[model samples]
Target: MDEEQITAAAYNDRSSYAKNRNKKRKSAGNRFLQNAKGFGRKHSFGRGAELEQEEYNYFLEILEALNGMTGDDTEERSTMANNVYAQIRDKEIKACSNQLSSRVLDNLLGFTDEETLQHVMTVFGENFRVVCCDKFASHVLQKTLFIAVLRCIGEMQVDEDKDASECRKKRKSDVGREMDYNLVMDFSPGHRRVCGKFVKKVAKFLLNNLEEFVWDSFGNYVIRQCVSNLAGITELKIGKGNSAEIRKLIVPDKWFKLINEFCSRLLVWPQFPEFPYNEFTSVLLQNILTSLDQTQDKFQMLQIGEKLLNDSFLLKDPEQDQSDERQKLPKVFHRDSSIRLLEVLVSVADPNFFKDQLYKRLFQGNVLLLSQTRATNFSVQKFLDCVSDKHILEHFFSELEVGLEEILQLGHTGVVASLAKACSRLACQQGKFVKLLLEALHCSDATGVKLLTPVLNLMPPEKQSSVQIHLHGSLILQAILDFNKPIKLVTAILETKNDQLAKVFTDPKGSFIVNAFIASKFVGEKSREKLIRHMEGCYMDLALSSHGSRVLELLYESAGSSQKEAIVRELSERVAQLNSKPWGVIINRKLRVEAYRQNPSQWKNSSKAIGGQRAEKIFDDIVDTGSQSKKRK
Candidate 1:
């Protein structure tokens, strides 16, 4: 027979055989469907049921094939994973098919192959809400999200590295590489398949509908991931990096509306429907702050900052320059959310506007009342740091003077500490302001002394000395001691007849004051001598106490030769006595070390010097004494 006639007859035979096999298969599928659905139950092939069943079977078959390909060879596994997803690509699955979609996604997550990642990228844009809202499918979407973010970032990083390499090449060679040259050209086709456009679309969609899922029980987590990571994706496209606010790059109007809505919600006490505080909302707020910081619209930042600081969440039309709503402001910012908003404002808002516009509002709003409440004190401290204008600093303190008694009433150790630290910053630039603050403290009634004494009592006598004193008091006092006319304040503090000076030297809370004073560059020799003499009566006693020993060490290190010699002479008689106490041993070692540092030869040759064996003996005694003390107790 001729070759053409033979080929045609063979094709006819094969076609007839395939038709017979398909007929049998169709019959079997129909029988199985009938049995599964039950014969009495009415069934039809409408609503794409036939196509869906076929697709379902095909999906399962692909999954089954991939399940067997789970060997150690990544290339083989990746190929199989890719092939499985390729079959489902662009095929619509019903909402009821979530479990099937989840399985497919989970398998991809396991492989995390480039092809599988690409498939996920496509599916994400196509079925953004379906994937995000699914009970089980959401997990795979989240994992896909992280993978996409990391991959996109990784691509940008590759581009960066290539640029660096190109630069090195240019320097090493004759000419710089052209900017039009694709940096990512060297990557494999597989590596270059990252869907940045799809990622952005998915991100934009998620952000557009952010409010829907931001408070969802499961959706919130996904929203948080999207807000935090998708910004990088957006940044890569825009080349804005961290300096670009998400609001500007994303839907700016929508972003502002979302932030204002949240701020409004924050204004109401005890949220209706009782939503759990989620990272999604917090991250969104942070992004708003970041946007405010990045945008050149100072007026917008000012308005938002004023609203947040004032806790005025009245829904204002964005087009309007100002709102006329005269809502009664809350006395205290009981909401934890407002604190972070205020913190970011203080950190990111224009310092000038904050000092001028908001500073007056803060005082007039009686926001100082926040200091009295533990919940809002941190925000108050943050507000304090923004008071850099000399005029504002003076005015704020002056106004604070009128209400100093009420302000003092709100002073907890922590609250007072924040005030002290704030005052310290003010003291650095505004000496007159600090003097006014101190005078105000001095003139306030008995309650003022009770309030101010904690600060004075805790102030380290010198600048460098550290104490474990109530941190609030210690910092305030440290600020006071660091002032230009410190002696004026010092003399007043010492003359209070409260043993404030001795308390600083002898008491644990006040001992850092001694270190501060001793380390002070301004402290004259006479003052140092007086400090040493005061401790002389309790020289041994102070040497044995934990906090007091630090005082002795500072004295030894800072004292002149004659004064140091006197300190050594007094301690030398008690050096053996110091051996039994930890604090004593510490002081003895300090004295010997300082003396050695001054005159190494003197310490080396002097038999009385506590070195080598003497120091060892003191440590041994300390261990023995501690053990004995423990046993006795």
Candidate 2:
């Protein structure tokens, strides 16, 4: 507990960090972070390396405890957190390196006073570049920025009121003011000023380090929070003189302009680049562009995509007379990272750009080839996702269907899955797709129809029977079942033998197919009864397994009064046996096993009292909740 007893944090090596930085593409932002000269670093070593390891691991345990501490912003929770905060005050620098310690620190900021926050800001603010480079420390800094964004908005508003009417500043003792603990930032103005000062320092720091933050893996995240979260402080408004209001910017204009410049730089790629693309940069760029798309800035994403895809480096000499070759798009977009970036670009590009330039240049005649290559298969799926026009989607289906079996043979299931979803959405070529799907899975038209088990399991014929179900196969079936109720698939499923059918019921992924079937709008009452009758003997086995219990519940809920009575009666006789398994207790209580065991006649009367209306939440199947919602609505 004594200050003398406190030891230094173990020193971490920046050799790998420096090596990773050298391998990444040269960008202005990364250069600045590389040149920051230990901006947020304080180094001192404790005891021996073994002792330091013990202390570091011990600190992680303490962090876990702090984050797991619960409260509803009550004084008790705050008091408990402060006690922990005091103990860690000496180990503050060391604790920041703990992966999730920031969450506990974040909670502390919300419940504790502004002085505690000021201490945090002052300690960490001095070394933005150094701290932001470590992944875990970056997480803590990001949380601090997020909270500061929310709290400062209120603080800036109060500050603006005083600046606008110089003599009208609200006093701290204003009796009518109420504290809203629900909002962490609606504090006394003095607290607001403290928060405002920290925000100001962050804005200044961000402006100075914009280039270094863009391409550095960990540093890029800090830049994103500043741009997305704290940039809005400029939007605060205040009443000027009489009847008019004007903007009261919290962060200066130069900071925002620099932020814009930083964003614009993220999208640029030269025709012939100096270095290979970095995955971290690709991920960050994707996030920024996606956020732009979501915020209705599609025009920005579209223009950026069009320019990146269309524009290339110019020939040095006009007399070279090779404009076409010089202007040709680079192979950068074909790399795994770039293709993923292109996926987002394709999704948000204008229909004119997507259908015309992309279809002709990237997708038109390359459908099967794209589907065949392992990495490019995703681009094939993206085409299916974005080509919303029936005519375009139809063209895709026609070509993809020709090689459908080949596509399946090669294990490129995502392309197949996306194609199925597209057809279902467009309501074009539904029957043909289903028929083709059979041949594709069977690898022969002659044997396709009878290989339903292989199709359900998404395994080739030799590998089919009881293999765990593929997630994509489940999605495809749910998509098809949503397609106006295909009777061929429905009848085929119902006619399958009980023992074979139970295999699908027991798989975690395959179990959802039962829910989708029962939950689909297409299957009428008689069809439901037929399915239930087929599954009767398998019910007890299904009830005993964990995943199987969910399917058993779905079947019981969808069954008619007669079928419900039968299921309850069967389960009643086996209630003690059913209770032996973990999920058995849940399934038995749900099936009303005890009530049925007490009196069958009484249970029959209760079923009739509901007047044939479907029970609430009973049809809410675990397979795909959206499946039924899509049908009923």
Candidate 3:
């Protein structure tokens, strides 16, 4: 029974072997169909194009899934949509070729929801290296990183709004206990769980493998995206290294390591033989310098700042013409980065931190060079904004005297503008800087006027003007008028032949200067009174001008009651003929004057000038004018 019965039984099971093989084949086919479901419906013979058409519309399904994730509170459909998302994410992994990855990523990023974003964040963290290093997956990774950043920033803002709302509610409750309210005082718990985690994960992963990422074709882009994200976070108060929130999320040593690693890259960039330097490193450096605030970090930061400065071009002796010095200074490859680093360093420098050698090198050793280098001059303004020491200004003046002509010869309008702005800002805090600047201007013979030449060129040309002056001069003059004892300068300008001062009121560029002069609290009240009287006489001329009209409108805001009445009366006489935009605005101001006069008590509370007081009156006046014009027609 054992041998014969066993042999016979085995022979009888032959059909079962074929059946089992067929069943396995069937199961494999089903798995294939499940993966290709995103690929659209299959086609029979002569329907290949139709199959492709279905596959082409696969993006629509992706979008539909994303819509469910991001869309409204329809609980019934959302459940189905979420199921679609899970299937797409989990089943599509191996089948998500580059093309499909792009489509999925683009749609997901474009229609980000809390759930979909959280899914991406989870996937990104788990397979970060593979995705980021992959040429195809890296694009998705970059876009997802940026979207993650936007999500984090949005959550931070929502938290801020919630806090603000809570504060307001508490204030309201304290004042009125009878009011009952139910408030949503917090963000979704899901958001709280994933919001900060993604950013920290991204930072650590990217920073740890920065070298590998920086060189890979697709990975470089991930590095760029990471740097950009860090740059933005550096500007945020919550993301700063020393912030309490940042302390909770990342240790000081880790934060310092991240920045120090980045800084070291900048210092070593020039040494790389084959790799071309990019501006992204510069951007990252600037942001890092701006973000680091702890006192312990200052010494290392100071060393980095000094390295950037030493690497930069500088003028050694102001007495010797800058031509030789300019020639001696090697052409820097990273001038922009060096200049920006210096700017950030100076802007954020602690007074105590920069009190010694770095201070001297900045203010005295390189002062002449900074003022003359076109790129450095912009940063020079930032330095001057922060520097309070009187000696620095004194040193600047002394150096400026010897190099005034050469500095002017550089012929950059931005340099001149920045110099004027810095000097003006300095003059506000101390009277001595203004005196020094003026004396330098006077002492240079024609170079002082040359310095003001850019200012003079800012004025718009006019047909009736006899003499033209530059508005660049006016920015300087305006600064002087605002903060200086500007009597001498104002008198000298007014005394110019061919009515030069009067021409400023109508010149497009110069008109702003005139307005600045009129509104200045520092321009001796008597000087302002004289200037206003002069403007009042030319009120009609100014109101009719394109740029001058705006200035005249400013005059209406700043002018005294008598000066205002004079302007309104002048505008009233010409309102009928005024059809141009400039003249219409003047007429609008005239309407405000009349409205305020008609209802002083009603207009009294309005802070804004033109439309603030009696908006209805202005409307009525417009209607009345239209009706009158119609009657005449």
Better of 2 and 3 by lDDT: 2
lDDT ranking of the models? 2, 3, 1
Error of 1 at 60 (Å): 33
What lDDT tens digits, residue by residue, belong to model 2 across residues 491-580?
Answer: 777777887778778888778878778777866778778989888877888888788989888888778778888878777787666766
- At residue 402, give the lDDT of candidate 1: 54
Candidate 3 TM-score versus the reference: 0.60
Give lDDT tens digits, candidate 3, residues 69-152.
312323433354345456557633332334543545443342434677578678778888777766556666766665555444
TM-score of each: 0.47, 0.70, 0.60
CA-lDDT, candidates in order: 0.51, 0.62, 0.52
The best candidate by TM-score is 2
* lDDT of model number 1: 0.51
Provide the clashing-pair count of each candidate structure.
7, 4, 7
Candidate 2: deviation at residue 87, Å? 6.1
